[model samples]
Every structure is written in structure tokens, then in C-alpha cells.
Target: MVSISRRTFVTATVAALAAPARGARAQEGSPRAGGRLSFVIQPEPTTLVCFNTTEGPAIQASTKVVEGLLTYDFELNPKPQLATAWSVSEDGLQYRFELRRNVKWHDGQPFRAADVVYSIGLLKSAHPRGRTTFANLLEAGAVDEHTVVLKLSKPAPYLLYALAAGESPIVPRHIYDGKGDPLQNPNNRAPIGTGPFVFKEWVLGNYVGYVRNPNYWDSPKPYLDALLVRVIPDGAARAVAFETGELDLGGSTPVSPLDLERFRSLPHLGQETRGYEYSPTLYGLEFNLDHPILKSPQVRKAIAHAVDPAVVLNVAWYGLGERTVSIVSPTLKRFYNAKVPTYSYDPKAAAKLLDEAGFPLRGRWRFALTHDFQPFGENFKRSGEALKSALAAVGIDVTVRGQDFPSYLKRVYTDRDYDFTFHPFTNMFDPTVGLQRFFTSDNYRKGVAFTNASHYSNPEVDQLFAQIAVESDATRRRALIDRFQEVVADELPVLPLMLSKPVTVYNRRVVGHTIDSAGVQGNFAEVWLRG
Candidate 1:
């Protein structure tokens, strides 16, 4: 945790890893069967309210219990889901969606536009987080019982992609109508979903399991009779659990060098141990422009200029990450702006900016950082120390304030207490939604569209962001994006750092499992056991 939030950062930065060499030999896909998938499910997010508040793995585990309106494929395209098809108006203001008929909630209630309306309403009215994630979509009014029509104040090109994310999961209002609190009730412990699996039971902090939904809408999904999720926190312990037959998978477990070596030393090389990016996650110094000292464009630029991301990639991560400049991963080439300047080892230049900004002495200000048990905590600490010394030489003071995740989230977003937070943004297929959400003034102190934590904004940047959201043309949209980033770079609302890599570990028995870039989507539907 950093000075920004005290409860939870609400977003996870664990995603991406250095991809295999371009010409690396290809391996065939493997699918395993049965033999329950056991791994860590953070006890922190057991209740619906807690998970909804922080939006962490606890609710992620619930993805098995609820289904989104749409799903995104590896390419970030909208895949089929509760909705069969959708349409956008020529003026870029109105959108209409055709619902997939004959779907049912876990309680066997028919799902219609009313359920969609109710879920969105609940998230905005009560859910502590993600209210902004659905901001644009909420602008619409349902056209009929089965059709939802959205009329945006402005054009938004990525609305479809945004709806595909789990943050926008649809809940059945019928079941939650009078169930007391939507969170913390017995219902969460025994939830229901239209997805492949339905909640069966939770053994407190030990495990929360699921069984295949016999009446599931998706064909050939949830391949197993039961999915067993066990809570194992220690990274090494999870890996060891897999090696010794105590676990079937490694959820949220870092595949460290020791684990990799252990897997390599085992009987199977390609078969037993698997490594890849499970999701698209990004980790960087989420700066607060709201703080006066950091508000200086020169100061923010200097920090970005001084940051040595490659060092984090090569040393802190044992060469597991990519030293990337674009916030959108290379996998998202369409949105990735290659022209963005890359941060190098430039402590001198960083100092120059501070001096040029009239802080001529050196190190003008200091900030605090709180600590979370992310794999990069040590890395950020080392980098922060070096930055402190570097900025001090040039008349700046950087104080590192470290806090835990829970505390960090509450303070930063809820209380607006952070000066700078080292955190990651969760990945969604649509970069526009992610970018616009964080930059907008309305989203500040709340949702994706909220004002910057740095409390910074510009009319021009705002205009460009709105334009890009509705500009469906690829070339034009990208051009608008570049302009937006240029303004951001000039203002230093956010200091863009490195693209992240999700370093994941799994057992040999787990097959057909490819972690998406966000590391969201356990995708248990396609996962099976082998041998």
C-alpha cells in the first residue's frame, strides 16, 4: 500500500510477462480432467460486500457464480454471452442490444432486461467500487422487455468491450430483492450463476467449491463435476502444494525461480510445469497530481524520466517482465502508441528538470508509500530509495510510505489520502474505457470516470478523451488517443511507466489453461485435468 488508499487498491496490476521468444518452438494444447482445482482464494474477500467493495479475488471467484452480458476473447473482441447481438446508432449516441432468450438465474428465475437494469442500478446505488465502470452504459434506457437501448451524452467506441468485463457482471434482482444486504448474506456463500458452474458451498477460509450447472446455457463448459478451490497464500507453499499432490492448481501464486527450477527438475519438463501470462495486468507508480508539489509538470516528467523500468524487469523480476512504455500491452497493438517516449536511466536529466523548475537545490518534496504483498513490493522499495537519493541530489525529497492493500484502498480512493501509490490497473479489452474512466472529473473519488487522484484535468484533454470514446474509426481513434496522451504527458496527470507481465504458476495436471492478460477469467470452462 502507498499513501493513496488504506483499504484496498481495488485494482490488481498482476499481468503480462516477457513473451517467449518470437520463434520459440510451439507446444500442443493439453486438457486435463477431474481431480479438483485447488488453490488460494484470499480470505479477505469472502463476503459479497467485501469483494464488491475491493473487487478482489473473492468476487472473482464468484465469476463462476454470475455471468457477464458479454465475454471478450484473447483479442479483446466481444464474445457471445447473455446478449446475442447489439447495435450502435449512426450518430454514436444510441445503442440497442438483443438479449439472449431463455436464460435463467441460479434460482431458476427468467432473466430479462429488468435484471440487467436492476444489477446496474445496484452497482451504482450500493456497490462501493466499479460505479464508473458502467457509467457510459448506464446512460442508456432499455427499449423493451428484451432490448436495452443506451443513449450516450457522447460517442463511445469501446462500450461493447467494457460490458464484457466481470466488473459489469449481471445479478438477478429477484433473488437479491429482499435478501437483506446484497453482500455478506448467506446467499453469497451459496450464490448462483448462469455460467458453467454454480456455487455449492464454502468451507470458511479453507475452500469455496462449485459444481457444474446441469442446466447451463453454455455447451461443454465447466468440464469437471466439481471445482475445488483451496486457500493457500504463500507463493512457495502453493507451488509446493502442487508438486506434492496437495493442490491441483496455483491461483494467485507467483512462479518464482525456485518453483520453476523445481518444476524443471521434476519428471516432466513441458508437461508438468507451465508458465505464461494469465491476464493483462500493469504495475507502476500511480501518482497523485492532487498534491501541489507533484502537480508540477516538470516534477512529474522528471520522475517519469528518472524511472528505470528495465531495472524492475531485469533485476526485481528475474527477467520475467517487459520494459514497456505503452499502458496498453503490445497484444493490444491497435491501441498501443509506439511513439510514447521510453523512460531510461536518466537521474541526471531528472535532476535537471527539478532545477529547471526552480527547485534548484535538489529534491523539492517527499511522498510516503504503503506496502502490499505484491511480488513487486521489494522492487518498488528499491526503486523508490534510489529515486529519493537521486531527487535529493537535485533538490527534491521523496518519502516512501508503505501500507497494506486493504488500508491503501480505503485511504486513496475513499479518503483521497495518498500522495503516490504504487499499484496496477486491471486490464480490460477496451483501453478507451480504462483511459477515459480514470481521466474524467466525474470519476474522481469514485468510479472509472472520476477525476484524477492527482486532482488534475484539462479541457483539451477532456475533449479529446470524449471524442476518442465515440470515434469508431480505428485510425481516427488512435490519432485522438495520441493527442490525449501528449496532453497528459505535458500536464503529467499520470506518469506512464511500464507494461506489466502476469507471472503465473500451475500444476502439471492442469491443462488447456492460458491466463488472459488481465489474469481475470479463471476460464474454468475450458480447463480440464490431465493424466
Candidate 2:
């Protein structure tokens, strides 16, 4: 990883001094259970269950109280959770799971094969990413009381990584059975599950509290007596809390970038970047293809050339991230294509392209458009200002605007009120599950928060994703991904900005938090304090 100082960005490899080895406790002493753990989640989660939403906070909160069929190690190999053992047929069409016995829900009901069957069915139809994640699923049937079989129409190579608790949580069949619109069900707000923690109370706009489940399937685990998630929206306040040692743990870079080095230097604090491999982030400029002016590829490509990613890295982001050329994250070395077309920073060429595209300078400006930045953090707002400044130099007048999270969602996805916006998306464990949703035609569902916000569609891109999804051969799949990147880069539906390296900050007193690939998003079934 690269280290950045306030004065300059230096290319250096530095091991996280505060972090412990992966899959191990922080200190050498045995863990002691009984203290309460307090953490922070920004912008308050809309629901406690993340089956229908992919908000990072909701996923982190839900996974503690909900479980999935399988877990994964640091190498991403499947590990035991609800499903103890599993096997796939030679044809790659059938998967059989051996359920862990003696596991009971928090409400005292025995977990059975029906829950897996029901949950997958809902996921394929309801979950935003699951629609594509489980598209090949032909049937989810129960072989017996403790066995379940999933038959697929074609191979899904990335299916294993998609079963982690955060992405695809298993819900109780009884409580949601025959319920009208699972999205609107009350269970989402107050979830009932078979995880290590139990939902206790949610004092709206303040905090959500949970008590350790005494009957948790994994006994003698979840050593903490209780878990408290405080809703601290401001980045400065979060940094202050960390300085005071009032917060125990927080993930996804909870504090501002300016405060990162301060926390890293503190003796009582530690920061880790290991656990987010399963969910790498991509920040980009999304263009509304339906708009009259942006529909031209020349204009989109010109805008891409006008902005400088170096300034984006050093000035706007404070060198917190790395620039990316393709929609797929560079962290995924196997499929990332470094040879794809790149748009370098060139203002003269941008003006020439606009002039050739028939939009000559009208007085002092070519055209004017409104811009919206993602309201999740302060960096994106600075990025908006940077974009406005950059475009103004190319004779394009830009009006930067800001809104709350809810209003931003409604205006962009549902109302289509803006021309272009700064957006961030999780490319997840694979390109098929994460990258496919942004360009495919079928995923352009109106009112959906994260799927195909740009309304960009191409039949060839869709075909490439379909082929990549079912292609079992590694060599052939890589070829298809390369072609997909070439087309998407040429079309320029969404300008690839930079790939983010998110950090998880925690007190040295915390242990067993970053033991898995999911990191803090894991169920925390075995997490405990060092005391």
C-alpha cells in the first residue's frame, strides 16, 4: 500500500503497524468476555437487515444478527457456517449443502432447509445484486430436514463468494412467510435471526443496541456482553470520539482522511485494510445517457479527458486512493485489464473534441450542466468542486449541488433530475456480480438505489457478462472480461475514476475482528475484548 503525507504523496510499501496478523487475536493473552463494545456507523442505516439493501452500515449491522450458508477464509476459500459441508456435481450444475444440526433461531425455532430455500428465492427476485448473483439458479429445493440442493441452469463460478453473511443473509421462513412485500416488512427494521447477537432496541436517529445471544449456535463466543452502534454522521466528531477512546471499533474509513495518520500514531488505536477484499470500492462520474447532450460518445470522452486523476488523487482525495482505468478494481489482479483505453489529462484535446462534436463555444462557454456529488462523505463534495473547476477551464460551465442522502437518491435514480453525478459502487468479489449491474440493460430498474443509475445499456456488454458468468474455464473467462472492459471503456457510460482502499479503525483492546476476508462485516460470532 502507498503512504501519503500531508505535504506530498510518496510511493512506499508500509505494513500496518497497528494491525495484527490475519485470522489471529491482537495480543497473546486469552480473551475475556463481558464488556460492551461501542462503534460508529455514519448516516444511520435505514434498516437492520441488509437482504434488500447494500448500504455498508446496514450490511455491517445485519451480519452480526443474521447468518449465511457459508463463510470464507482470508484466501476466500469456503468455510463452515450454517452449511457445514458442501459438494458440487461434476457438471457444475448442482450444489448440495449439509446443514449444521442443533442450530436454533433466537426465537427458539430449529433452522431447517426451508430457510435457505426461501431466502435464495427472495434474493434472486428482491436483492439488488442478487438478481444477477443468483440469475442462473434454476431451483432451490430441500433434500431432507438437514440438506438442501441448488440446481443451476449454468455455471456460476463466483457464487461461492456471494454467500457471505453481508451479501446474502439467510432469513427466517416463519416470520416472513406469506408476508406482503418483504421489502416493507417490519422484520427488516427489527430483524430476527440465528446469529451471535440479538436485536434489543433502536433509539431512532441516535443508536442501535444489541445483547449477546446466550443461546448463539456457536457457544462461548461473542464474548462481549453487548454491542452498541452509535450514529455519528460528522467525520470530525467521529475522529474526536476515536481520540477520546470513546469508540471501540468502526469500519469503511469512518473518520476523515486528514485524521487517519493521527489515529495511526496513537498507542491505543489500530487501523486495518485487510478485511475489505470482498468489497473493493470504485468512485466514478456517472453520466445519464438519456440526456440529450451527454448521449454523444464524443462529449463523454471529452469530459473524461478534461479531468485530471492526479489532482483527483492528491488534491481532492488527499492521496487516499489509487487511480483506476477500468471499471473492475485493480485489486482483483486476475481479471483487471491494465491495457484498456485510457483518457489522459488534456484540455486542448477536450476543446477540439467538443468543437468537432458540433458544440462550439457559445460566447465563453460550450454548455452548462448541473452536478451532484455523493453525500456519504466530505471527500466526494470536494471532488464535485474539483470537477466544477476542471470543467470550467474547458469552457464547460458546471453548477455543483449538494443534497441529503435520501433526496440525492430520489433525484438521481427515481426522478432523473441531474445530468451527471459522482457515485461510488462496490465491485465486490467478482466482476460478474458487481461490474455486470452497472452496464447491463436488464438491470436498469427505476427507483432502484444502486443498480444501473446511469441507464447505460449495450447488448454486447450484456452478452459478455452473460458469457463470463457461466464460463467455467479460467483462461476463457479472462478473455471475456478483457473484451467487456474494452467495450465499456470505449463507450464511456461511466468515467472510471479511482479505486478506494478503505480502512477499519479500532482500539487495541479489540480482537478477533479482522480474522476473515469480510473483515468487520463478518458475523463477529467470535469477537471479544482483550481485557
Candidate 3:
């Protein structure tokens, strides 16, 4: 999306996009260790555990308390967190991790290799991404108290990059072992992990507070005495809080894009476009194929013609988006196929297609449908409004609906109530880990939040994804990925709108906030205050 090639893509893109905000490093002083660091989380999280859902707000809050087996450096290479060291077999079937000892859960229980084994099992069954990321795993066995080996049925090329805390968090086994559903476990709201921060309290519709863990294995880090994850649903209020110095940090373009330039003008503030490489995103419209009216390919293509990607990029994203037509995000240069079929905005062509599909206009209206926007941010709401306007011109009466994050998930993934919804999804480090879940036939779980809500199933697409997962050869993998994108583009399950280059706005008093690629989703161990 930022004109990054495979050579300088993952971490190198940071410097490529860092030209505008060179002052991001202007604050130079000894790191202070005792002030509270407050940040913002929009549309408060439904749960604080990333083991079940891939909800953005939940991952941002939970990673501060819960950690994974490994964390990544700025260059997207694996580094130690809970696991001190790791090795892989020559055949690429077995992965052995040497766990860090003397690490204890927040509840004062010892963190053992059994926790890693248990958490891996839970993620395989529960986590939306893990369901595919760990599908090749045969078992996670504890060799000793500090060693756990992952035996896979086949080689997974992207397994190492998929273990970041936000993607696959390691939950405490003692707290979740015999617990009643992991998804319904009370610990989800109040989690227990061995990270540098300890969960303190969560006041619904208000804030979730965390204090420094003095007993953290990574000692003297997470220099803040306390951390506050403030939940301010109003964008204007968030902007005011930042300007007045009430809020210290915010990520994923927390405020409206219109206010980004004004925030940059404030000498006390700085903006960052780095550290989001771990979670490059794509925003678009996803449809429910189960709906009878949408069951026809002609109808789906007609609706696609009525939509405009440029409108979504300008009106909804405020020119902060790169228009894309492929289901896979262009930021992932290795697998993104630019030659995929694209839909052009043509109202005349849309009307003809709808008429041929047995939806002749009746008194100036061909049909009516409900549109839902992902409630995490305001940008999606604006995109839905734009879609309503475009579809109306083609004789389609549309009603845009608004709801909270949890309710939106239940309606779209479980109830399958809507005709189509506009939202954004993170196409993580690899397509097999992120893009496969949206198109693969096996990933169409009804109750899952981020799975295939579209229920799009193609035998050829499924087989191509299966082959791409285990194929380690560079040339062969690219060819397989190209075919997968071509088939999915022709099916038109979802209309790709744009790719996001999200910015993180923070106060100059905050230091080391962009030290890693995960951005705010990363643990704040290295983040310290300049005061």
C-alpha cells in the first residue's frame, strides 16, 4: 500500500513512511519510571482475552497483561517473551521452545510449560485465527517444566510469525483448565498472565486500569507506575483530551483523519506511521451469501458495480486509504496479486445486471437491503452511509444500521441477519493466517466472530489455500497464492474498497511507544515516559 516491495516491506517500510514525522524522536531525556501512561481504546472491548475473538480493542488491552510464547522485533523476527529460546527441526515438523523460568501468573501461580500446551490447545479450538494458524499442529507436549515441543502433522510456512501476543496469547492453565467454556470464562473480562502489567479493574463504558507488575520476569521495564485504557466513544472528546494533555497515547488513527494535521501542529504531539506492519489492514464490504436475494452471482456483481472504492477512500477514509480491488491487502507484497478482476463503478451496468437477475425496478426501487458497519471506529459508519447513497442511485433502497461491537458480531456471524456489512480486517503477516479464514470452506463457523461470515465456499479456492499452507518453495507458493486470489476475485464474496495506512498519535512526553511492529497491540514493557 505504501509502495513497499518484498525487499523492504515488513520493518523497512517504517523508514520509508517516516519522512513526515521526523520529530517523533525529538524528545530525548532519561526515561522516567513512575508516571501513569494513559491511552485510548474506542468502543470498549467485549472481553480482554485474545484467545477467543480477534476483536481489535480486546487485543490492545489484553496484550498488556497477557503474553504469548514469543514477541517480534521491529524487523518482524521472533524474540523471546515467555519462551527464552526456540528451535525448529530440519524437516520443519517439530518446534521446540525453551520456556523462561521463575515467571508467575498475576494470581501468584507458577507459569509452567503445561500452560503453553493448554493454551495452544484452547487457541486451536477457540481463536478465530488460531483455528487456521495451528491447524497443522499435532500436539503441544511438555518435555519438562520449562520445555514445550510443538509437533505438527505438516510444515506450516508462517507458523513462527503467527505467535505474537495479540494473535495467539498464552492464558493461564490453572484459571482456564476446567473452566466452563473458555469463551464464557469470567477470567476473560479479568485475565491472568505473566506479562509486565497486572490487570487492576475494568469499569464498563469507562476505562480499564492496569498497574505495573513488580514481580514481572522482565524486571524494571514497563516503567509506568500505572496504565489507563480510557474508553471515550466520542471522537471530538478524544481530540480535546489529547490537545489538553489529558490523554498521552492513541493508535490506529484514534481521532478523525481531519484532526490528524491539527494534532501534528501541536508541538507537544507527534504522529507515527510505523509499528503497524504487524497488523496491516484492509477495509471493504462483506456480503452474506446465504441471503436468497444475494445467492445469485449476477446480483452480487450488480451490487459491486453500484459501489465506488474512490468514494469510500475519500469520504470515509479522508484520503488516508489506498484503493484496492483484491481481497488480499497490497501491503503484503509477496502474495498480493494485482492482476485480479476488478469492479468498476457503472450505474447503468448495475441496473442492467439487476434487471437480468429478475429484480426489475418497481416504481423506481428494485430492492431493499440493510447495511451494517463495523462499530470499532467512525470511518466504517461513514463508509456505510456512502454505500447507501451509491446503491440508491441504482434503484436499491438501503437502510444503514448502527450497533455496538458485541451486538454487531452476534448479528452478522451468529444470527446472519444482514444483507451485507462494511468493515475492516487485519491481513496479518501472511495470507494463510489472515486471508484464508475469510474464504476457506472449513473456516465458515457460524458462531465465530471473524471467520467466514460470507459463507463463501469454492472447492478450488479451498484446495489452493491448502496447498499454499504447506508449500515452502517461494516460486511455487506465489503461483498458488495467485490462483487463490484470482478465483476469490471472480466469486465476488466481498468487494474490496481500500487499504489503510493507519497512524498512531501520541504525546511528546511518551517515549518508546513505536519500538516494535505490533504498535499499541504490543506489550508496553519498553514504553516509558520522558518526564
Candidate whose TM-score is highest: 2
Candidate 1: 10-residue stretch with minimal lDDT: 9-18
Task: Using TM-score, rank the candidates from best to worst.
Answer: 2, 3, 1
User: TM-score per candidate, in order?
Assistant: 0.79, 0.89, 0.84
Sort every candidate by lDDT, greatest first.
2, 3, 1
Question: In candidate 3, what are the lDDT values of residues 30-87, reduced to their tens digit?
Answer: 5678899999988789999888887789999999999988776555666667876676
Candidate 2 structure quality by residue, lDDT tens digits, 38-69 = 97888799899988888889988899899998
Superposition-based RMSD of candidate 1 using all C-alpha atoms, in angstroms = 8.3
lDDT score, candidate 2, position 217: 76
How many clashing pairs per prediction, in order?
75, 0, 0
- Which of 1 and 2 is ahead in TM-score? 2
Off by over 4 Å in 3: 1-30, 101-111, 174-191, 202-205, 290-299, 302-305, 345-370, 374-378, 392-417, 445-449
**Which stretch of 10 consecutive residues in model 2 shows the poorest summed lDDT?**
10-19
**lDDT, residue 354, candidate 3:** 96
